[model samples]
Target: MKKNFILLFLSASIIFFGCREKIVTVEAEKNTNKGGLLFKIDKVNAPKNVVMVEAILSRTDFDTVKASLNLVTETSADLALNNIPIGAWQLNVNAYDSLQAIVYAGETVVNVQDGIITQVNLTLIPTSSGLGSIYIYVNWGKIPTTAWNDFELNPILPSPISSTPPLRCNQPKVLYDDGKFKMWFATFKYGFAPNTGYAESYDGFAWNVVKENLFDLQKNDSSSYSRWDANCVIPGAVIKENGIYKMYYVGFINSSGEWHIGLAESKDGISWERYPEPVLKANSTEYQISAGDIIKINGVYFLYYSFRYNTISTMPVQFTGGISLATSTDGKTWKRSETNPILTKSQGWEVSRIYYPSVIVENDRYDMMYMDGSGTGFGMASSKDGYTWTKTTTRPIFTLADTKGAKAYEVVYPFCRKINNKYFLYYSSASNSDMLTITIRVAVK
Candidate 1:
């Protein structure tokens, strides 16, 4: 057999074609007392743009038995085989393109024993041998410690702890200024109807929460006129420019939760004043704005927010959407990006939604850590122009499983700040797997 390797493109549609190999089950036997072997696919070597591949395992004795694996990914996964009755086997893999044509092929031989696992490696060549040279790109960007760490620590004040554990708290926007770290977030006393709260810290660890809400559901509680932010308030981003503190926040009109981005200004970061109305509303009735983050590049303000499809099923749930862009000069009246939704959903952990973008602008690099879910994962993406983005990895940067602090049902709302060359990440996680008892937690790198 001609031996070579294949470029494994794991994202293609799998086709169940009839091969003459007479395939059998690849599943391992329960508590197998005899022969079995485990194979770890360590590398994906493939020609460019080949999106799918299949593997065939066969071993001939008095009779022939075969098993086929239809799909393989770039990520490493163990291919477990059990009860093989102790013998040598043939492993053949073929890479296919969208047209269901084989582009690359490789085969190898392995031995199986009573309790040992076998490993196989191969190099593939193009089916069209003279199709020039092939190039393969495997994206495996790992989150470095300098990027951020997944270490979890004790919660800050009014967190999962303090005087009374919060039943619900999230949308934490933390800012570092004048040798102190200040946080503005939302605390839920009436379910989704949250009230924005404030806290201060000198070192970003021990925190002091203000006794009262920062800017409540209204510009003032005494105002009887119905305001756009009357129902709920969630803090999004905070930036101080020209000695004035500007807070971009998410607001809700009623139980319908037509979320909009609103603004509030303060001098001392304690007492806040509102704009009386929302600064930005949804683009259409089919969409609902969730949260907004702000970044200033070359004296231009960039406000990026997340919006979701306004369906009946999604309205009742928490935030899940894609990140869109808008720009402003004075940081007030803004123009939407011509190419909106600069970042979007991906496969695996990010398939359901990508929202709550917290971006940091460092020179030419725009690093964004956003909420990636079905629930409990955060993803990172980088951009050069701030309009087009590429995900850092196929997986979440760090999950709640990396925290080892909260037994969380869902961990969302990532707001990141880089201070003194160290990254500070503040987000909410459920306390002990109880969704209602959500609170803020911090990690530093």
Candidate 2:
């Protein structure tokens, strides 16, 4: 049976309301023409005694509207307005107390698409916050508003190494340490990640690419006949673990062209050594997989990897992409989390195919920057425990149009690093949409 649950949260206030059957529909994932919405209000912002809450979902023509049951939730629950028709929507949410008094109310925009799971976290602005009539603090799956100043600069540095026709630089990992900025990128032909390059700068802006390939696949054990990543090798999340630098990379097989996660190690970010075997490999259900980001929490390593499910037709869109998690006590031996796919595509520019997640830890939250694989755009998300992420906005914070004067074809592979309290995003442009031919650029905020 189709069902929807409603939840209300606020600080020092509690409200409970109900939804009309004609106004909402809870759906199953079997529907291709519809999408899912995960609607939630921050409990800390909710009052102490909300007995009821009302959730209203209104949509446009393209997003189909059908009727479903609305169940009143008694406590904290996983919020969902599932199988919603894909289109722009308006969600009006309100909270009520035991006396049925409306203490907090707010409205926000929601966009839905089949396969894309949109998350909207609401914070209630009470009357005490000055001339406010209860506004919803919702980022709607985009970057935080306080993020960048829309500052972008082109031609920051050269490709990891020089490349010839049909081969271009792709996938970058940047780091800031000891008052210097260092970068590692890959050089690959179409559909193959074969080599890595290095660059450095005293300042995060100007960079000089050393004319060297950090590691050649032909020289590493990856070149072995039985190695899964013999065909491709892309640089991924690099982090310092136990005073030793670890690199998690994407590797592809020459025969099946399948994707796998590989490992490398370095004392410094420069010279590196590789693990003889793939650390993570795709199962029968995954079409392709690549590393997104990695962070350690309480001695456990959290590895975020982007993947596409085997069923393309069942997706909201053909290229629907999601990010999942795997944990390892020893970065080499790993196990997939039961919660796999901790993140999925959100609506707007990220409705399908979001990949290459770059993340950094700030305070207690994990901040993320991912590429919109369906289009040339980049967006942000955050997580508390490195599993469930909150997409900051509904739209991409920046896109191909944001990179001025590049006049490039497809600008992608967004790698962000925080230096001096500012985020520096480094990305490249592909002459062809398939990540061939490269021009690296940067945006600071």
Candidate 3:
């Protein structure tokens, strides 16, 4: 009886050990299936006093946490966190000063796939109020650092393989939505025969030209006012209304020598059809419409454009006009504001001409970045109502000092877009080396 009892105990022990080994193997396999994250963080204005970093990761639902990491750092750090579960996660990173207070903070959402390492790049801005809203009148927040690249994209359709005069590209309209970053710009060779073109990118930095001349010059007719846009078509502001893309552009016949605003619609962001007549024309022969910015608020379209009373042969094109405002209910018929020119020449930097108004309405205020006719640089203004604008300062908000002249001849045509909670100001300029060739550049805040 004692021998049988010992044998039974040994058999039970062997089966239990076998089961334990199988469980260990399965657990190891599960660990190997996990994914990781490698984050490359760029500190926009990291203080010299920053001494450490605190990085935290949580599930997208905020119900569970993956990791809480702390590290000693200098001005900036490249952080790595591994073994994150395969799913969506939010990363909140903070840069701390010597006092252990958060000097800068940034957060971004990332997707981790099984057995894959996801790479993320982020620009961290300071949490201190010093980094955000500093203004006596118009609050522009902070000045941005410029991102200059040598990449160039030529006109897609009207570009001749070999032409007497080279083609030029300008006026970029950037949009990030539906999982893609898209741009629509104008390109023309010689003469004012401009057309709208398309380019796209997975990331905003590198661009791929998709289609050139998506919308070409409209058909010309006999009537002078009706034929105003026959020669060249340059798109100003593009927005989606009722599931369709609408573009407001300045159309002009170089021969007629006057410009007016026209409207076009597209089912897709690409391919467009123009309305038969100009939506907003120069009712007052005193001023002719030029390129402007448009935004929709409460189903009303606000159009802000520059205008010139008469063309001067010796005057530079950029300095011809000031900024004006008009409103449209259907984006077809429009009413010029009672106070027509909302913003005009107010300071020496403006050179008695202010145009290229880029307006962003935020927090019950209208924030505008505009270029003066001198092409010296841009200025900032704010308004409660779109009509009564208050210039932030007499100084130019963006300009190139004497030493920076080698970088760009002049900066004009400001456009602002916000991505990942960061503000990017896009504009066209000519480098001193290639003053005639216009190129696009960006400044990030």
Candidate 4:
């Protein structure tokens, strides 16, 4: 009986040990099925001064897991997943708020192995916002910067001309004509002297003052008896027709201190003849209309200007100004396309005033340059169609840099011209005392 019991116990022990071995093999296979997952935040190409990286993970089993990871000194975030279960996982990463929300979220997926690290790399995008008020971009490819000839200490125009007192030259209108470049500019000079002037350039470097004090700011002998643009002609000239140079000049009278626009025409690029009647008149009881630059695209002429004080009696007030558009077929009679300002100062340096629009058609796109006091520099806006404009990234195309104790004030009227596959920007610069001095600079593509 004892011998029989011993043999039975041995057989039972063998069966139990064999079953345990099978269970161990199954667990080993399960462990091999999944590998380690590894991930990292790529910050090599990121902008400077980044703080933390915000990460989000999504999967079939989980909704979304979000976390803000601190960045190392290398501006990168390293993450490791050791012995992760075999499955698909998605990751999204963005920059932290302390970094000015500069980096955009990146997404990716990976499959993990038990002991293997599945490396996945991510790239972050830079943050961008709409342009504030003015937009200026240099097309250096077409117009090389090296092509711009340096100006003498006191250069003179190719043609003999005289220099007048520095006027408050603001809005600039430019066009190529008769193998020469011409600019019509406006200033804040009150009285009998013309507020708008004309300047000509052969190679867009040295300017020759063509017409100085060209417009008669005296009161017109009419029933209106309104002196056009008495206080100033902010933005001076617009090309109404191909050969006809029409200028929408601002006029203010001492009687009411109200501002209006006067229209004038020029053919030879110097002498201008003003229309006996004011092309656009301001409402005495309501807001006044101040005209800006006028541009023609595909035979459609658009007048972009501003309006202010459309309400009851108030002090000579400049309301939140905006850019408005007017359409004209014959370039004579114009009707307001929309009774609203197409573009206005919503934010940035131009938040206070967004006036003096200078537009140029490049690569079938309209690039408008204007000024903003908020930052005291120039900004840019783009428009596919002349009417609808999208404020682009407001980067100061030009700024007042102090040079030898003299500080530049503002960059007004940026005119772009291409020469020998290079682009040149002829702009007017002034000091804080409102001295009008034109500066010619070039940018290469």
Candidate 5:
């Protein structure tokens, strides 16, 4: 009886210790897999008497929540939530009044990497009518009354060093950073393939061209898969993030003759090394990808690009084109919006084509300047969210006639810049007499 009692006590202690060890191990694993969020809320078109805002982090399916927090305030406030399970989450926010009635609500998707504090921002949209209508304070102030100077910087940057006659200078993507002006432009010689070159300016007008190309075609046959961009590379958008200058461009495959969105990075805004393959491609066989503009918002990279059907039809003639959006966390991997083709051909002036998007977010609103491929003009549009757009009542903000007697018949590839409270629109203008020849021009407000 005594031996049996001692054995039973030993067995009970072993089981208890084993279970305790398992509990501690599971707790440590849970802590290791945790991440955090720093959230900022902006209330636009919100009702008065909003007393509290609650943020909930839920799974992708909206089936379960991982964590949540609340802030009581009448205005925008920043809050931090810690120790959420490291994974993908959708942030849902609800603005409540003193009566506990829901006033405004919104949700945005985000990815939480291990041991990282991902920043998120939510723009609240009201669930019901309110006192003040939601208005985006773009504050772009009066449109420029001043006529664009054709001579200010026509043919802004010269042709390539190896001069081929009838030089082509088009698709200007300029960056004003660190008190200096830099540009990545597409330069095409008469018979040679098109490539991207660099230029710099200290005063934003007088430019000194970099002698070499920033991006070029691969040195292989176009038919080879290795030569994805063996024919042409054109600059799309230029942005500086975390001290690194990144360029999103369009690369054409000679064999397929289809364009794809490509990426390249530089430290000095010149001398870029491109990735081996295109980062974004067409999911459908009937469309080809084109130039894209990228902007970072709430720790997510939003890329808006143009797509036209594979029919090779002409605008105002036969075919159609539209604008789409894709989001990325690291700016490499991308997920296309399910509701794509956000902006499509609609109005008479557009003529069935809308491509070459130059987009920026100002005052919690998205502003885009784009070209209608069939027309000789470009228009302006704005959005509260990046997905849906509304064209400005005064369409074709700038047109070929706006340049007056510049022989600029067609205007394409618009890039917008705002500095010192002034707005500047940079675009490529085609010669009215010679359609093949192109020049760069700028209009300032």
Candidate 6:
């Protein structure tokens, strides 16, 4: 035949132009795999209605691959997958509604390739009638009362007024009298002898360490000059005005290596009256006062301590701390808060230093709860004029995994109270040990 029909028409025109050049090489390798994955959906402040998310992919033999995404929604949900395909896969979201039920389901596991995206951020915990029930207001005024209706706040007793064993303790100070509640702490026995303890709760976590040596450095009776300084007094009671109970301690003057703030006086809470001098005195050789914390609000009296300074060294000392404020009308002549160090050190976990300031007068505000000494735990600040403050980007309300032997190099000092609507936080935890251990946490509405 004519040269075998021109060699079969040049082999059928080279198999029809090689199948038209592979039809665009199988549609451009169907996503050539340069890596890609990005899905996000967080809804904790929840409350939205249009739902219908699907996204599915699978491999490892579960066989079903249909990818091509891009679903956005601003404040949350954002998924984007392009040119995926490099290896392990298995996503599978679902979020129906419109009565088709389902509500939400998730699964994850991605790998993709090298251009980088692999995000994966999902948080969906709704389904308790679509969840919504945590609106606590507890007399939220911000504080300025004359005779009650300032919404009366001090409710904390839902179940933990007792756990037993020096299971941690801090600067708690409650004495509602005659119906009894008398609690006062500062124990660290598990970390080894930190005195000034007393407990008796008609309800406050079932305590009972009544006088575990209320200021007793092994009975240093210089003929009852009442010597106590195996290193601490730590108390901070309060009741003033005719029912007299004032306590306020921080002692450690071992012949002037200085750390004073002592002053005691009780009437029916079981004998005490040590005040031979030390109404607060580190007398600034460049600052040094330790952890004090008093409050008499409105009739004045503040205190709040923890000021340190000495970093400009010629090689004699070198410190640099902060957290000061002072003012007294008669708690014994003080004065030092013309806005003085109201709070400092900003940035995640309190930046570097902010110490034991624990005020509370809720419903008219004045929260404070310091000790972020450089964060990993304990922080909260608020004031409507306890001298200006706000701090709280959901800051460390309390952490170090909430205590156990504490660690992110521990140190905390919260101490709050509000009993009938609930909120108690007696905190303190130490690590590089100078012996600090105390704990009590409760929060309700």
Query: What is the alpha-carbon lDDT for the whole of candidate 4?
Result: 0.50
RMSD of each: 20.8, 19.8, 18.9, 25.3, 23.9, 25.5
Instruction: Give all candidates' CA lDDT scores.
Output: 0.62, 0.63, 0.59, 0.50, 0.62, 0.51
- What is candidate 5's TM-score against the reference? 0.63
**Residue 41 error, candidate 4, Å:** 57
lDDT digits (tens) for residues 1-445 of candidate 3: 0000100000000000001110111112333555655433223223355555455666633344432223343332344444455666665656566787765555556566674435443323222243211000101122334432221221111223224565456777777766556777777665546877776644344345667667655445456334667776787888876788888888876634567888888888788888777888775543568656888788888899888776555556332568888897878888888887888897887876888888888888889989888678888899986778999878886775521212567777778877654566667777545566665555555
User: Residue by residue across 1-445, what tens digits does model 4's lDDT show?
Assistant: 0010100000000000011110111122334464433334434323344566554556664445444545544333444433344566565555554635533344445544344434433322232332111011122112332333322111222123334443445445566776555766654443444366677654443355666656555545564444454545544446635677677766665434466667777787567776766566666432566665677776777777666553334566446466677787766677776545677776566667666666777788988767664436666789888878888866565555412112445555455545434445545555455454543232222
Q: Kindly list the per-residue Cα lDDT of model 1 for residues 1-445, writing each as its tens digit.
A: 4423221112121112112233243443342434544433223323454655556657553234443333434353344444555556565666666677776555555555554433333333343343211212111112236444432333443432334434356778888888667888877764335777787654465455764366545444546237877776677788898888998888766746577888889898888888877778776732678655888888888898888865556546554568898888888788888787788897677867788898998878999988875666888899998888899878787676666343556668888888645568888877764466766777766
At residue 141, give the lDDT of candidate 5.
Answer: 26
Off by over 4 Å in 5: 1-155, 159-162, 218-225, 312-318
- Cα lDDT tens digits for candidate 2, 312-372: 4664535456778899999999999887777777666775577778888878988888888
Compared with the true structure, model 2 gives a TM-score of 0.61
Give me candidate 1's TM-score against the actual structure. 0.62
Q: Please say which candidate is ahead in TM-score: 4 or 5.
A: 5
lDDT of 5 at 30: 39
lDDT of 2: 0.63
Per-model TM values vs. the true structure: 0.62, 0.61, 0.62, 0.55, 0.63, 0.24
Summed over model 4, clashes come to 29
lDDT, residue 402, model 3: 23
